[model samples]
Target: MSHYAVFGHPVSHSLSPRIHAEFGRQTGIALDYTAIEATPAGFAQALDAFAAAGGKGANVTLPLKEAAFALCSVTSERARRAGAVNTLTRNDGQWHGDNTDGIGLVRDLTARLGLDLRGRRTLLLGAGGSARGVAPALLDAGVSELVIANRTPERADALVDLLGEPGRAHSRYWNDLVNEGDFALIVNATSASRDGLQEFSLPFALAASRTLAVDLNYGEAAIPFLAWAQAAGCRDRVDGLGMLVEQAAAAFELWHGVRPDTAGVYATLRGKDASLVTAD
Candidate 1:
């Protein structure tokens, strides 16, 4: 079987192995996919060992995305723009990196969540790797205005400047959310909850009755932000599960030369019934 894995510090919770197994079943491709725990300091060494062990490709998550990017021999434009790499493929004794996070999030938002990003006023919380990965895609999706907010004002400004869309993208201090006014879509891209940090106490007025709230963290980590959105009367809320599944499909395609259908796998994962998964 071809070998693959996902590398992250706290990756036991990842559904990637199961997701890719289903994809392999659908395509009749024998593959072994697993999770490998690796900290930033050990990432390069772990990756090199994986490549030596017949590993074809892998996914990088959390604090390791930027580290993965630095190790890549070459990268896609999106990866370069994000300054992070979430997907890696071994080729010609070197690694080729790509950032599938943005496209995955966009597909989940537009196709699964029925969101029309065109001309929408969107608020992106956080200016870290997660934010960087998706900001360009959000702009490409045609958000009329993208407001990035973070505790570190300089980081937020730096991300906006990197995006290179001065007229449409801007940054704000986290405490200034109230004066920034309400937004149609508010996405929590921070790792606060995932890192066990205190839940963000955002201004309620920043959301309106028609606002949609999103948290880029899944499972228990998503609850704090989703709960806040609920109390604020957000019309809809979403966790990162959809994006996770979509991004896995993208990576599967990149690795195996085909994109398995994601709907059934997503439903199965969401409903916790593996028997219901269908790759077709």
Candidate 2:
């Protein structure tokens, strides 16, 4: 059987195994997908073992994406731009890194949610890896302008500098967000959502006009931000579940050369309600 898994420190909580299993069943592919918990110090050893055992691909998450990028012999342009890799494919005795987070987000928004991002103004909260991973894709998808904001102003400025184009992308302090008016889309990529921090305040006007408020952290991490978005009267509030499944699908495609149907798998995984799955 072809083997695959997701690598993360706290990976036991991931629903990837269930999601991919459903995709495999639906697509008539035989595979084993599971979650592997690897601490920062142990990731290299774990990866080596998996590769030696003939693992075809792996999905990486959290604090290890950058490490995965460094470990790969080759990396996709998107991964290079983001400085991180969430997907890895083993081929010809070498590992290749790719960043599918942005593509996943775009697919969920444009394909699933039917949101039109073209020529739309967007506000991206947080300037960390999550924000950086998705910013370039959003711009490429035709977002008229993107304003990246963070609690620490310098981080946001640094991302802007890294992106290197003032015409479309800009950086601003979190406090300045209130005066920037409404945006068509608002994406919360901050760890604040995951940490259950409620100290961050957003502009009421912006919140009200945002067609979608997307929290990159799903399940428990999404609660605080979703609550805020609901209270702020946003039209649609979504978590990262869709993005997770889509990115995994992208990784599977890179390895198997087949794009598995994700809609059914996404709905099935969402219905399980366990957040994590185990082999029976």
RMSD of 1: 3.3
Candidate 2 off by > 4 Å: 198-200, 274-280
What lDDT does the true structure give each of the candidates?
0.87, 0.82
Candidate 1: residue 52 lDDT (0-100): 95
Q: With candidate 2 superimposed using the best TM-score fit, by how many Å does residue 243's alpha carbon deviate from the native? A: 1.4
**Clash totals in order:** 0, 0
Worst 10 residues of 1 by lDDT: 271-280
TM-score for each candidate, following the candidate numbering: 0.94, 0.90
Question: What tens digits encode model 1's per-residue C-alpha lDDT throughout 1-280?
Answer: 8899999887777778899999999889999999999998999999999999999999988778888989999999999888889999999999999998889999999998788888889999998777888888998999899999999999999998888889999999888888988899899888888667656688899998899898888777788898999989897998888888898999999998998999988788888843321110
lDDT of 2: 0.82
List model 2 lDDT by residue over 92-142, tens digit each: 899999999899999998899898889888899988777878888989899
**Which residue pairs clash in candidate 1?**
none
